[model samples]
Target chain A: MGVSVALVITMLELVGLFTFATSGALLAIQKGFDAVGILVLAILTALGGGILRDLIIGDTPPAAFTDVMYLVVPVVAAAVTFFAHPLLQRWTFTVLIFDAAGLGLFCVTGTLKALRFDLGPLQAVLLGVMTAVGGGVLRDITARETPALVQADSSLYAIPAALGSAGVVGAYHAGLPLGIVGTAAAVFVFGLRVVAMVRHWRAPRAWTRRRPEVGR
Target chain B: MGVSVALVITMLELVGLFTFATSGALLAIQKGFDAVGILVLAILTALGGGILRDLIIGDTPPAAFTDVMYLVVPVVAAAVTFFAHPLLQRWTFTVLIFDAAGLGLFCVTGTLKALRFDLGPLQAVLLGVMTAVGGGVLRDITARETPALVQADSSLYAIPAALGSAGVVGAYHAGLPLGIVGTAAAVFVFGLRVVAMVRHWRAPRAWTRRRPEVGR
Candidate 1:
């Protein structure tokens, strides 16, 4: 049962990888990165977090090396964006959904990997959060823009991933069915993100004081 | 004695950080990254490896947070490069030396950290190698270039760091004087790199058959 669920999750993760790669490539182009930059961003967005996670876990010959599909997916995604850029721009929502799916899958995969490494729950959740957003963070930085995570106040990006990771871990510990639990966790994260986008729900920000008035 | 040696190495690492950050920032400007991109590259080159090292060791908050100097050095380096790029370009050799220093320091520091976590010698050495070169790999990919490590015809970059790390660990186990051992390791790695650069020494490539002969 766990094996089947893991396989399903991996498949979803691949789709997510492709989507995320395309989004990264498009963003690089939008930011005026050259063709080389676009390809680089695409691959980085798809592979960076996994590489970091694997390295931390002492997993040699990282996932990108062992899996031909992982390598192929991002390249094909980048090529599609390169050729169909006009259509992609016209259909921005298509990319956004893919990005969302990718985000959900990565968060789950990252959380699971951390748990497999026997990390504490909080650490597992944090790793999940990092995995979900790390690629986008790398993409923005490479393109030389303020990271969307820091700049986009309206997105509850990290929160949803954190919650999903926690839910999966919690359910597993509580003896919940893996398939039901994993699917529910993914759906919860995906739903929350979509809702946050549509409703413009945002994390609360602290107001900054300007030139504090003489020890008021 | 060990503490003093570590402090000296850390100080050199900071200097190296400043130099590498400046190089990254200069490259960003050359690529026409706005202020944001330049700063991102600068920070990545400065903190990327250390951050990876800390994370692998499960060090919460990472070194970047513990050492305010780490943060300050990269920002200052970026600012200097932003303003004095023309002068920096002429001092490329100086920059390379600084980068080499950072690489050597990280190689040692990463190895020590891995040992502290009780990893085997091979694992510790591998971690050191990863920590030394990981940032540059990330930076190159982000900048849309091939990682120097994977370049087919490049001289030995990571190999020297690996050898240096092994030397340090071996010295520690062999009851050698700590200060002399570390200094020797650093100087050996740095001198080897300098020689390689001057001599254009490269790793031997495997020979491949240009054409297939008919089966006997």
Candidate 2:
């Protein structure tokens, strides 16, 4: 990877990590968790997806554990949220944009990584989506709520990640430059997610409450 | 490893996997999940810890995915629970014993595996406890509940797993025979867990509610 590409990926991943960590901290506050709980949620939200990806891909100890900055980023985000709740709360829109960027970047990166490990393109795309959304799934679980990925109330979320990942895979197969592929995929996902948020575009939910089947 | 020891470990692990899967299925039933959710929970709860362990230790794709029996056990367990909810519901104590057995075996085996991978005794013991409790954690999270391991209302669960892992580590470092050491540790965890359950030996909960602090 070129130095600039490497730099872009790292920066986007960091942005995603911080946003998810903030989300986690906010949930912790809502759940009335003490300081320890906030930290726990933030750290998990930041690292959970990557950890799961690393584990599945045979990456031991996970980069988050080996690299100090990854751990420090979540801690800093959580601390900031804990200390400045109101100020940060008002910047929800800004945070969402960063989060969408992070999601887009992670999906592309995770898919490419999985592909490098010889996973099928389909599997790679799934891993990409998982990388994008896994952290939030963990965050919700920790806070005792249905994961937003699977919730009825949420707008299209995982769909954008999947679409972004598929785009990267498609671009790679078509021999596009890696830089262009990654950037285009991330922008598409980020743009779609932001638009979905604003316009309230939603994924269809399952038919509501099928009548309980009669007598077993 | 001796054939006898290997056989014993396999049997115990199967029992553990089945029980944990049952626990997952039961929880899914409680949550009113459909067939797909029940199976997902069952399989995840059955295989999650081992998957996490293998990943941490750099084992890719996880053994559960490759081994058909491992996949089959949870599927069967979920199907049984789905078909015979009332009958299985009455067998809760039986399921608990099996779950405890699985926990004990997993902790012992997980620690031994970590040791073989050259993880320090401390890290190995932690992996051991993780292997014991990881599945249930995934199950609870998927169902949007605090894991019983981390819950304040639960009896000593993770404690027995930890103690079992510790004992194996202690025994190994003390230069005991592996067979005797592993069996003893498993038995100890199993006995402790069952006794704790029977006695309702609760872990102390943090004080009910310190009145949520107001005014940020």
Candidate 3:
């Protein structure tokens, strides 16, 4: 709750918002969607998970709906992505880094938020993962694609988020300071995600056709 | 709030739950999803909208999550659909009827719930439409299909839901008895949806390539 810690979380959130909105707008542009489509996807990507979480925690109107800045930031990000996409296309790696950072930041924050709302540690962890990945799942669904959260062959996503969520929830249960535990959890998630991406790590596939070991 | 009125809404809600769950299970079966997949979609399609509405209305834990019967009904429906989809496939018209019934029922119920939470007429009506159509959107998203809720070529899905929501909100605004207005609003939606289906009514497309007069 110190000023520096609060400042860092805020910065992470803003960066995450921008990256998620950019990704949403980029997807819309690729799909040849109109301006409205771009705006809708951008807003949903940036704030959908938080809205879902707030709603579950009995927060009416949602923070996004109330905070003009939160709403406007995503729109601004989307507009920039839409207009400067050609130049931004070359910055895919940077986008991925920022996206991973955002994922980590959100998972820890979400779990902490749930804990603050007096949810059980288990529910807190799960909701944390939901908050981290829900927006991307929604964005993919809107784009008519199999969401990465559920896809078996996709790179590490929900798993890393879940780990980060568990970390924060566990730390909270151990009576650790929120600022320190949150930072450590976020770092853990961000590091794992970035490494996984760099190594092209694929998660386990559940329904592989090559299950010859269980042959009839 | 009369016993009879409450009973009627309860009946409609149960019927809607069954139909939505069945539709969700059927979709999962069609998509070759496992039992878990069927159950997930069934539950989501039956309860996702109400959960969304409750979250929006600051109703924590959601009724579906808390009520044992609400959780069980969808599971039962999914199981039935899983085992009897072949037989149920022949009952397409029956499914349509139930789906339309659910659409009407949820809109009114959601709006009423929102009103109970002291929401304004606009939010109530919007939440009503969201409750009506949200399950199907989640269902389609899970199926990796473009949801009909926002598709241009799809029939009057959101339109009818919105109209039903508007009817209830308007009647309430006009100070009509809840029991009478609620029933009447549901009936109006059901009748319109059925007629639209039978007549093959298609809503107009927004982005047709043949905006011929706009250019050479």
Candidate 4:
């Protein structure tokens, strides 16, 4: 709530937004989408989660649409990716690192926002994870690709976000200073996500079970 | 609004929800998803559009979550699909008819809700179309299918919703009685959608354009 703390949160949010936008734009370029599609995907990827969060919490118009800076950042990020994607292709891992950072930061902030809205702890955690991963899900769906969220082959995504959000909720309930605790939680999620990617970690599929072709 | 009008709207909404839920559940069963997956898809498809509409307009918690009847309708629809899907499979065209009816009803209701929230006419129309088609989009994405909204091969879907929404918006601004105009619009949308489906109408894709492998 303090000015300095708010400023730090804002800075982190911008970084998260930028990373998400870049990821979306790069994907659009790779998919052979047009310029308009690239811009739309980038903006949606950056702002979709927050917009979803605000809407669920009864926040009207959503902060992303209201704030000029929030809108501008994604456009700039898209432009950067649109022109320089070939050059940026070599740094795929670097983009993934930034995307992980965004996922981490979003989970913490989203959880805090839900708590502020007086949602129950469990609901807050759910919303936090949604806020972290929802945008990428939207991007993939729009591009007609299978979302990594539900793909067994994809590296761990939602688990890190859930852990980050759970940690934030715990710290908040424990009366810890959010400025420090929140940052720590984000770093933890970021590290976990990066490690999962490096190690090619995956979520487990359901165990094989017998079932009749018809009802039980 | 009068009590009778409210009752009619609620009835129509339930019908819409049931149809959407049936569609989702059928898709899940076809995809060989488990019982839980069927229920999840059914509920999400039934409620997703209204939830999106409510969130966008800052109506928190969403009516779908708050109203027990709304929740109950979808569950019943899913149950019907799960237990009697073989019987229901014979009525695939019948289900599509019901889905078109739902689409028609939702566009009118969604536009009216947006207008109530003081959105501009254009914005209201956009929301209306979103409300009508949003649930189906979510169902398709969750099932990892291409959304018909963007698929050129698919029959006209969002188009009917747009037309219905636009009519509602125009009638409202012209001070026409919504009860009458809204119903008329819904009927028009339903007719158009069924015709499109039967005739195999499709949206046009972009024309061929020369481009480098990289950016223009």
Candidate 5:
């Protein structure tokens, strides 16, 4: 890992964190959660994925917890959304774009981290996709909603991430310059997500003859 | 640290995993999920908490993944529930008892693991409670239901685990024999959970003047 590459990854992570936090804060606002809830959701959405990634790779304390900058970014994003959400609420598309960027950035970075930890390419792809979607899952769970990732009617979310992660792993294994390949992969994922959202593309739901019902 | 203590803790963990898996499998049956869903939920519910704890403490590959018995217990539980669900469905109280037992055993074992990893007592207690309830939370989330831990109308769940974890931490700090004290704490938690269920005990929800609604 060159110094320049590390710096780039850090910048990408910061951007991803800020965007994810904003989305979480907006969702909290929409959910009628209080101010404290907004902050909690924001922080969780920002750091949850990275924390999960580090944990899987056996990193202690998690990088997000150790770095003050990572913590500060989400808090700042939450506070901004807290005061400015009324103005931001009209721009749902902007939020979707930001979320796509996060999905892209996290998948690449997460795959890199897993590979650095000596995980196989297959496992790396799994962890990378998890890193991209884990925070949103946590946020939805805390907000008492079914996570969109598993919702049959929801637009494609994890597929783009899996593709991005697989690309990164392939690039790494082929001895390609990761800094360039990683950035390209991230952009590819972001584009795919935006297209999926705009086109309302959905993953296939299970076909069942019987009506599904939840019983106590 | 002693061989006998290690064996005892392992036994508790296996018991906890089996019970949690059973609860998860039952939930899958209630949700009308397929056989694969039942197995996935059972494995996740049995191993999720322990894995979370291990990740926090930088334990790589997670004991549940590395040890064959840990994986085997959940598979067996899921198979039992899958074949015998018609009979098991009538015994809701039995399922609840198993869940309570899991809660008790996990709280004790989780705290002990955290303490061994040199986490502070407060942090250890938090991790312990998380370990006890984390599986249930994951299970509910996957089943597309609000986690019982945070649901306003749900019965007291995390509270007993917190109390048990606190007692375990206190006992550890006091240099008491951990095996005995830990067993006592687990028993105390189990009794508290069963009583709470029987009595319909609930943790208070936040009082709100405004109507609460989830908006998209």
Candidate 6:
């Protein structure tokens, strides 16, 4: 039962990968990238976080190498966008919805992977956050734009991912039903993030005029 | 003696960081970046790899937050480049030399850190290679170009860094003086890389045609 649940989650995560890849390719197009650049950005946006996660866990070759679907999905998404960009640009809100789904799936998947590696809860949560944001971070860096997660005064994107991961792990330790508990956690995170975005909720900034003292 | 040797290496690494930061700032200027972009590129080029290394190792806040010099050097380098870029552009070769030195330092430092954390030889070497090339990889992605490391035909950048790091670790285990052996290893790597660049030497590519058997 747990294996089946994990499989379903993995499948959803792949869907998320494709969505993110399309978004990346669209951004590349907006930036006047040629075909090659669009393809590269798509691949990076899809696989970059997973690659980082696997490398940190000492997994050789990485899942991006082993899974044929992972590679095919991104390439196909980029090619589709290349051909249908004129039509797709009309559905901008739809793309953001897909991007949000990808974010949620990746956050949970990353947390689960970290836990499987026997990392502590804090480390697991951090890994989850990194996995959720890493691809977008790579995308922004590639586009030479300030990473929205870091620079924008927006609701806590990483914080919610961390919270969701912690919740799932907590429920798992408490011997809850895997599918029900995991789904609940994911929905909670996704819904909270949507609310935050809609309401324009943001993390408080402790703005100060005084320079903080530095320790040697 | 060990402390003094580490300090000296750290100082040299700072110099290299400064040079790379200046180069990054100049690139930003050529790309028509404003002040924030210049600072972003400068810091990213200088400290990006070390930050990634620390994050992968599950170190919080990273070394950039711990060391004042690490933060200061890049900013100072950016300011210098902002004011002196016209003159510096004439000395491109000199800047490249400094960049090479920084690359050597980062590779060795990364390898040593991995070994200290009790990772095996292969893992240590991989970490060393990533640490050396990771920043530049980010830089290229930011610039929307193919990473020099992964391009089909490029100079032997990562290979030498890996070999040099492995050599240093191997020599250390064989009971060589740490300072002398390490410095020699760095110089060997730097010289080999320079030769490769000058001679346009590169790793041989394997030809693959599109075929069903090729598993595309």
Please compute DockQ, using alpha carbons, for every candidate against the native two-chain complex. 0.04, 0.14, 0.12, 0.13, 0.17, 0.05
What are the per-residue Cα lDDT tens digits for candidate 4 across A46-116?
Answer: 99899888888877678897878899999999999888887865566766776798899889888988887
- Error (Å) of candidate 5 at residue B144 is 4.8
Prediction 1: B-chain TM-score: 0.87
Q: Top model by DockQ, which number?
A: 5
| Overall local distance difference test of candidate 4 | 0.81
Native contacts kept, each candidate: 0.01, 0.22, 0.19, 0.18, 0.24, 0.04
Across residues B34-134, which tens digit of lDDT does each residue of candidate 4 receive?
55456657877888899989877878867774566777898799888877776654455765776788799889888888987899999999999988889
Among all candidates shown, the one with the greatest TM-score: 5
Predicted structure with the largest lDDT when compared to the true one: 5
Q: Which lDDT values do the candidates have, in the order given?
A: 0.72, 0.77, 0.76, 0.81, 0.84, 0.71
Between candidates 3 and 6, name the one with more favorable lDDT: 3
A1-216: candidate 1 lDDT, tens digit per residue? 368777866786788789789888888777778889889999998888777666655565768789899989999999989889887545556655666777788888877777766666665666676678788878776776545553323366667777999997887678777667777787888888888777877653312122212100
lDDT, candidate 5, A87-115, per-residue tens: 76466676677778889999998898888
lDDT of 5 at B123: 99
**Clashing residue pairs, candidate 4?**
none
Question: Can you list the residue pairs that collide in candidate 1?
Answer: A144-B37
Clashing pairs in 5: none
TM-score of chain B of 5: 0.94
lDDT of 3 by residue, A55-135 (tens): 777767877888787788899988898788888655656656756877888787778777777777666876687678777
Candidate 6, clashing residue pairs?
A141-B142, A142-B141
| Model 5: reference contacts kept, as a fraction | 0.24
TM-score of each: 0.55, 0.59, 0.60, 0.62, 0.63, 0.56
Off by over 4 Å in 6: A1-111, A114-216, B89-95, B210-216
The model with the greater TM-score, 2 or 3, is 3
